[model samples]
Target chain A: MPKQVDHEERRAAIVSALWKLAGERGLDRVSLRDTAREAGMSLGQLQHYFATRDDMLVFAMDFISKRTTERVTARVLALDERTPEAILRMCVAEMLPLDDRKRQGSRMSISFYVEALDNERLLSHAREGSRKLLDFFEQQLREAQDRDEIPADRDPRREGMIIMSVVDGLTSYCHLGLHTAEEALAMAMRHLDTLFGAAHETKR
Target chain B: MPKQVDHEERRAAIVSALWKLAGERGLDRVSLRDTAREAGMSLGQLQHYFATRDDMLVFAMDFISKRTTERVTARVLALDERTPEAILRMCVAEMLPLDDRKRQGSRMSISFYVEALDNERLLSHAREGSRKLLDFFEQQLREAQDRDEIPADRDPRREGMIIMSVVDGLTSYCHLGLHTAEEALAMAMRHLDTLFGAAHETKR
Candidate 1:
């Protein structure tokens, strides 16, 4: 029997190398040839996986988001039966760049954001990803309100926007060295507590 | 007598053309040759003002920041004898991309931010500008506390950080079309009111 190659694994390896190069230099330095060199693969092999540079970038961003979602899922599962506030706090904290890996992810995200400003395909992917994250947070906030874990008067949509804004903002600041990862997480936690904890306390 | 060339005006024109090109295409597309073409100047003439690509980018970013500071100063001056909260609210709202001009400024900022990730000289300029903005907010917050305009127990540093984070976050969201500029300004205003207005009201 002929040996079968793991295409998914190969692509993942390419993305990993792409991120390393992007982090060391800047996202501006990423190119199909350079990515192939970094991945130790021939340009033909990289082209076999990613048709174009934008395709590779889109895949890289998707891969990062998927990895983040997996980590978030595991954290949520570990906190089984926890309050909505607890789950949200965990989710938001995990979304922050709390480690080297996540910081690199955040840098990649900034590149995506800046590129999306002028690239339609990348812009659509970014918008879709942002919309999904916003929707997930909105659903959680709505459920929290329903359970009275958060105040009933809270607007899930608005709060969702706020949560997303805070995460993005803090991550950027953390990347800039204005704040440490620990401080960013702590500040996010405090913001959440003020939003969820204060309302519940006042109601009680 | 030779015609007096306005060197400052010439540089401003180059920076304006830079922003226009950067806005239409991604920042990566910006080059000395392209910028010269877009600005309708010979490459040699462009080199007279900007020796390198980095030099041009640094100059463009500084020009944007100086323009913003000028607007902030004008707004503050217009609100003569206003409360700290009023001045701050105005400043925060003004900092957001509420119109075409400000949005272009924000786009340029995002460009600088991404480039700064790898370029040390640009990164230092970005850091210095960020520090100055943060310091300005901290000073305003401290003055507010001293004047009893806000709660005495408020932490100026923390509040300043929160305000900056919120402004930066909202601006990014606005750029992404996640929220309208009006909504972004409203959210930021509400956040500021919560921090300064509510506490002082209760005290009274």
Candidate 2:
């Protein structure tokens, strides 16, 4: 048998190219032709795979959502002990625009988020992705409370919400350019340390 | 003396129209002719208000920045007391998107921020607006600490940064319909109370 190309890998390649195209031009400006060209395929071939622009967009968004979740689980699975620090390190790493792929992914996510402002179906996809991120943070908060890393009296959900908000906030700041990707990540890590380390245990 | 139409008021009216149009269709999609038409003026009249499309974009962006600052300051100044709870209440209220005008204004600001990514002059203006907002939070953090609203040991800069981040993240959620604006606001407010209440000396 001749060597076989993987269908899943090929689909991912298309999504990868689509993400790059959307990042350079805003999502509204990216077209099937542009993505096909970027992916080194004909329009016919691209359409054969995606069938429609909405299909392509959904695939691309889900592709990103899956990859991100994979990275976080991989990090957690590798941790020796899931301390607040260990969990936070992994979770915060997921938020950083650490490299070109992640940066483009972030830009695409941002544009999609704005577009979702006008489209509920799209917003549902966005919301699921958001819930996953927040869930991971809340789980960590609960784990920390169990381990007595934080005070038992402190509400995990409320604390988790604060951490999640800051993560989301710093992510936008990187795109908005209040800080570089590296700078924002570092600043956030510092901020997280304060809340999780000293302050949480102290009662009012 | 014959009443002269204040250039300032006319300029504000023109910018207001642009902001409204941006909310309706986004910044990139809004055109000079359409904006002028929406503002109930001819192209020549709009030109007298702003000479070119580029001028209008720059002015519109600058107007957004100034208005946001003014809104924050207006609320802060009007507050009768500088108590930590009072200040937190005032600042958080200004930061939230509880009404249509504030929501539209914020959406318009984000639109300008995206446009500013490619435009250097507008980038500085946008950055300055962001920095000023962060500074406002920082000042509030300091004030809160002095008044025993928050822990004195907490780093004001980092706390401010995180709070700003939380505010931005909630706005992203609101924009994407992840949560109702009121629900998101309530969630955020509850967490913020924990953050402040934990650090303070007051016991309930």
Candidate 3:
């Protein structure tokens, strides 16, 4: 009997291929034929899982969302001796395209965001991903407050919104295809320092 | 002979119809074809001015951007007696769906943002809109510092990012099709209150 394929890994492989394809061009240009070719799989096999373009897109959106959520989970678990400011800086820094994997991920996600606007089926997934990310930020901000890295009276909800907005704005620097990743990070760091500096924090 | 159509009025009519369609559905769903029909003009007439679909979208995007800039300018010009805190609040409030016009404008813009992500063609228009909005916020924050509505040492860039993010978050309330306008505005107001209250600004 043929060895049973690992379903999770197979799904991940397909998504990675699709995301890479979408990133290289625009999501509008991605097709089942291209995805299958990129994955080195039979068209029959690709269709067996996704069956249609919408199905593939929905799955790919979910895949990226899951991967990002895992990153947030890892950060939460790793919070140790570092200050909230340090941890936040590091966590946000990771979202930047400082390396190939991150750059690809950011590019794919940015492209997906554009597609999500017009496509009814994709919009919900995109919106949900944003909500989850914001919730994670809220949780992290609360942790920082609890750790005495932020003021007790500082509203976690508002702070989280502010942090997320700054992240969105920073992405525009790259989205413009103008600044180097390092340059964007530096600009972001300077702004973050002004907003989240030690001077602004109070011990619990 | 039919009264010669006012050149500017015809273009404004098309743009007005385009925004109305965008608010009712979205940017993607409403095509130039739909726009022509809505404006009671022939497809040829629509093509006469825009020349292509891209041209139409660019015009629509600029239409929104121009109107917003004008409103902000008018508001700034009108501020004679209110404190800086009052001014910032008023400016920020305009971005919220506190009324029908703002809500419609936001929903339409959210729809366009998806396109702006990767369309290098579309990205600059979005960036221009954001820079104008942010510059206004930054200017206000600086003025507030001068007037002591916000902390004197507060960095304008960071403050502007925070404000912009809050506006983006509020966009989710409507664009997500999840929260009613009232609920979203309430949540936004709560967050805004927490943010400004934390600063503990001095009276004018």
Candidate 4:
């Protein structure tokens, strides 16, 4: 029997190459040929995976969403007690670009986001991804309120929206060199501390 | 002498055309020919004002910074009382894309910021603008502290950065359709309220 690998794994490898290229150069400079070259695959092979630039872009954007979900899921699973503030902090931190890999991921996301502002298909894809993330945040906030981890009087949905905004805002600031990843993370954590009450205080 | 006007005014008109184009389409779609057509000027005339695409981009970015400063200046001038919270609220609100005109300005700024991740000249231009805005926020915070408008224990520079982050976050959310302009403004105001204490309480 021939050695076999999942087609999804192979496709992800190609997408990874494209993601790296996107970080090094702007997304505008990417082409099928360049992507093929970066991926160490033949042009014909890349063509089999993505028929057009838009196809690759859509796939890349989707891949980014999946990557983020996976990271958040892993973080949530690893938390020991699953306290509301702990879980929230872990989830928000994962959303931020706190390292080189995350930073590159964020840059690609922003590239697609700006592109989506003009492209309808990309816009829909971007919106779907955003909604999914917002849903996750809202759900977590609701859980915290249910557990009495935070004040029940606070509206989870509104607070969820604010948390999401702070993440995106810090991401933008980091990209512009206004804040380092560490500083962005610290600022975000401070916002959380103030919102949920300090971590230790909430834990008690 | 032939009829003459300030060269700066002519350049500003050209920049305005580019700004409109950027809003209608993403910055990636802009080109010299397209900009010339949009401005109703010959390529030669546009060239006389801006020698290269990069030159035009830099000038356009500078124009954006100047326009924002002018708007903030006008708002400050019109204020009846320049208390720290009042001034800070005005500044943060102005930074947010709370209406169509401001939204377009923000969209253009984000487009340039993404481009700047790959382009150094644009990065420098963006950095300068961000620094100016941060300086304005910090100065207002300090002034507020001096007047006892807020607690003196708070670090003005750090608080200034946090406020800036919230503004960018809300702006991104507004663009993504997660939050309406009014909602974004309200959320920002709420954050300010929390940061400075409730309106009357902070006044005391």
TM-score of each: 0.90, 0.88, 0.78, 0.89
Pairs with backbone N, CA or C atoms under 3 Å apart (clashes), candidate 2? none
Q: Across residues B1-204, which tens digit of lDDT does each residue of candidate 4 receive?
A: 899867898888888889888887768779987898888889998999998888999989888888888888899889998777788888888888877888888888888888787787888778778877788789988887787665665677767887877788778767777668888888888777766662246353
Per-residue alpha-carbon lDDT of candidate 2 for residues A1-204, written as tens digits (9 for 90 to 100) = 999978788899898787777767788778888899998989998998888777888788887788887888888888998677687877787767878778777667778877777676777887887776677677888887777666666677656666767776787777767888787787777766655665455532
What lDDT score goes with residue B90 in model 1? 83
Best of the candidates, lDDT: 1
Cα RMSD for predicted model 2: 3.2
- DockQ of every candidate structure: 0.55, 0.64, 0.26, 0.64
* lDDT winner between candidates 2 and 4: 4
As for candidate 3, its clashing pairs are A114-B114
Candidate 4 falls in which docking quality class?
medium
Q: Clashes in candidate 3: how many?
A: 1
Tens digit of per-residue lDDT, candidate 2, span B94-162: 777889888887788777767776677777776777787788778877887887778777777777787
Clashes of each: 0, 0, 1, 0
True-contact fraction in model 2 equals: 0.72
Model 1 achieves a DockQ score of 0.55
How good is the docking of model 2, as DockQ?
Answer: 0.64
Give all candidate RMSDs, comma-separated.
2.7, 3.2, 4.1, 2.9
Which candidate number has the best TM-score? 1
Worst 10 residues of 4 chain A by lDDT: A195-204
Chain A TM-score for predicted structure 2: 0.83
Worst 10 residues of 2 chain A by lDDT: A195-204
Span of 10 residues, lowest total lDDT, candidate 3 chain B:
B195-204
